[model samples]
Target: MDDQTLRRAVNATLMPGFQGPDLPAWLAAELAEGLGSVCLFSTNIVDGDQLRSLTDAIHATNPAALVATDEEGGDVTRLHHRAGSPYPSMAFLGHLDDEAVTEQVGWGIGNGLRAAGIDLNLAPVADVNSNPRNPVIGVRSFGADAGLVGRHVAAYTRGLQAAGAAACAKHFPGHGDTATDSHLALPTIGVDAATLAGRELAPFRAAVDAGTLAVMTSHILVPAIDPDLPATLSAPVLSLLRGQLGFAGAIVSDALDMAGASGGGRGIPEAAVMALAAGCDLLCIGTDNTAGQLAGIREHVLAAVRDGRLPEDRLLDAAARVGDLARAVAALPRNDRSPGSHVPDPRAESRPEGTPHLSPAGFWLGDPVHPLTAPVFLRLSSTANIAAGDTAWGVADHLAGELADRLPGSTCVDAADLTELAGVLDAAAGRPLVVQGRDLARVPFLVDATAMVLQRRPDALVVELGWPELPGAIGIATYGSGRGAATCLIRLLAEGSR
Candidate 1:
């Protein structure tokens, strides 16, 4: 192949992320040279206007280049990272079991992305959260039921695509049954073929039937299909998605920088080559990627083609698929919704009228009781998983101005700081105490601390901001820590105080 033909083919298969909010000079140059796509993270976003400008800049350099973001609209959000996401999580929607509401939420997320000039959204996680102890995909998933998750995935895909943003159902085959986080390690799904098809692959099949524009591969090992390689590097697995699933959309690989993909003595460049050979049309090369890294991956991909390890025809086919996706997205009617219009705080107007009265925000475990006359807020802090990162969560910051003096504000206590729990309990001596936490069931220390506090202040109300797995506690589970969930909890608390 000629040098220019080889360069364009290699560039079209890469979807890389770069540093900062503004477009870096090197990335701009690459876009002009035929880089097919770029993925955005929280660091590259400030607010809606800046994000729109960034995407516009990307398109200006290369109109065919796709702009993608992980705007899952719940726990894993990039557009609304500063303030939490305005839409309820997939778990909360599943708990409600209302397909219309789920579709509306999906449309809202896609509308926001479309207004921001983003083409693709890596979202609508199709995994069934079969394992409650799963660390990565708890609230991110719709639920444990295969049928429920599959239907919701289909609804979300339809809604998102209708709003002009392409939806990419992710972590293919399944990533919900494993205990390990794929970002940190490679998780193996040991289930048999029947279980895998009935439970894991069911939602992906639904997504394909729903005409989803793309599907993202996971860095997981399914012993039933391919024992040696993860799905991103396994031809048998990708072929299952392509042949059995009858999906003609672009196939995207999960970020190659994850330990699950690049670990075991292999670097990202080799992994990129392997992923393309495995049938991934577009490779996401992780977050905060540098110019040198992109160049190195391109070189390695080129070298692989020259060495006959990766066929030139295969490379061209992948690039063609990516081009087709971009062209499809470009052909859609322009979304004229004003930028930043869909991101309003959803506490008041967003909820559908006559909805189930399981409290306005979340369901209550017990009878409605206001045990607090004088209240002290205690926020239990724990290590956020790698996927959620260190983005601020909860309503502490939002409630500071309103309840500054009377409530004495919220005290943040680390999960490991067991000694401080006593002092916190002591501080709320003659008052009713309210505690907040995220995924309390997942953290042993947080669970023990919550139990210890409940022992002392039995009337205390627990507010769970993560997944709603905290049993035996008189609390409200918001199902997520996003802006919508936080606002609902805050309103509930305010009503009780009044």
Candidate 2:
């Protein structure tokens, strides 16, 4: 292929989203123009059968274009709300303290994705949860312990690959200790090289050794390496993963729409250019990106290649890596298109890299599976849908006692009345403030309330009710506002403090 065509092919390597159950016409036009990939979200998912057809539509346009989704399978399954996933969050697997369990969870989740024609899973977050105040990667991570996360990272990678879906250990060079969510703002990893090498990079090391075929880069900044650019756009940072970690597979950038990528005066299109220049094989425009936005990214990257702003050789190499991933996905040994056909043998087929051989009884660890693991996979809490502030307040009051009983010196409040809430927030300013609510991004009043509280008390934490990303807050998101979720939060707070 010519440089311009290859440029369009490589540059169009975006995982953009569309509305409804199938591929919209606008996106199909762009995909025909050499768009590299498509990513599915909950909005895009109807069921496993529906997902297979959706990816088939993309395949019709470009057969080898990787159909990917963030089926993290625990708290962040893209297909679960519509169909369902058997796996829980990594925290549950981590808490289980069994690498064999983590591998089974991966196989179960991977089997679901394979049935749906989603070949690439941009998941098994390599981030270690080194900082509990991290806005994004809390329960999504295995745990705060370095060794535990590393062990499961290898296991998750092994299991997913064993189930015939390519595993991508993600947020590389680590997103574990940042206080910011890259979706909203650039998060700086403040640790030194030694600290990062020991804590954050441990799981990535394990993942690479476990033979993961792809690695996704984080948008967070690391001053220990390149102080200016985030890892997504930093050659040195990507080099560390490639050179020091010896990851010889596909390297992907986090979403270009993120503040960590587009923040600091860089636009999404330009960020895509920089990402390809920096060594990312795939430039993700994010699940929320539109057809026009994806087209623009393709156009700009092509211009960069033509004008020599991005070297042709570099783009060619990255494009080859991407093609490699597509080929890898194409080569998986599934018998049929049926999602359930690849149901992995938990004890025999989908074991982790270093996990010891186990008997069939160990599949459920000598207990029934569903009853034992339901708490980890199930939704934990719900925010009262009462639009009235006072009614929500009453609900919070009812739940506050349940949360308070779990941990001393902890309480919950509905951010309904600012004047009244401000007084309560002021009183608790000295201690850790944990605030959780639903649709936090949509509720301007709630967002403002949290921001105000954080302004006065810069140490306050905000947990989301599984909605859009919350900005400018240093806290963990439990993906729910229920009692069980609150207990998880309380446990995080208690463990973090000690």
What TM-score would every model get versus the actual structure? Answer: 0.92, 0.71
Q: Candidate 2 lDDT (Cα, whole model)?
A: 0.67
**Worst lDDT 10-window in candidate 2:** 371-380
> What is the per-residue lDDT of model 1 for residues 1-498, given as tens digits with 9 covering 90 to 100?
798999999999999998799999999999999999999998999987888899999999999999998988667788777766767778887877777667767777787788889999998899999888788998899989999999999988877787789989989989989999999999999999899989999999999998899999999999899999999999999998999899998999999999999998899999999999999999999998888999999999999999999999999999999999998887765443322223233334533221222234334445564534436667787676777776657766654543543334444333346688888788778766778777788778888988898889887888776766646684777777776666556556656522
What is candidate 2's lDDT per residue for 317-364, written digit by digit as tens?
Answer: 887788888888777664322212223334234222222222222111
Leading candidate by TM-score: 1
| Candidate 1, residue 433: how far the Cα is off, in Å | 1.8
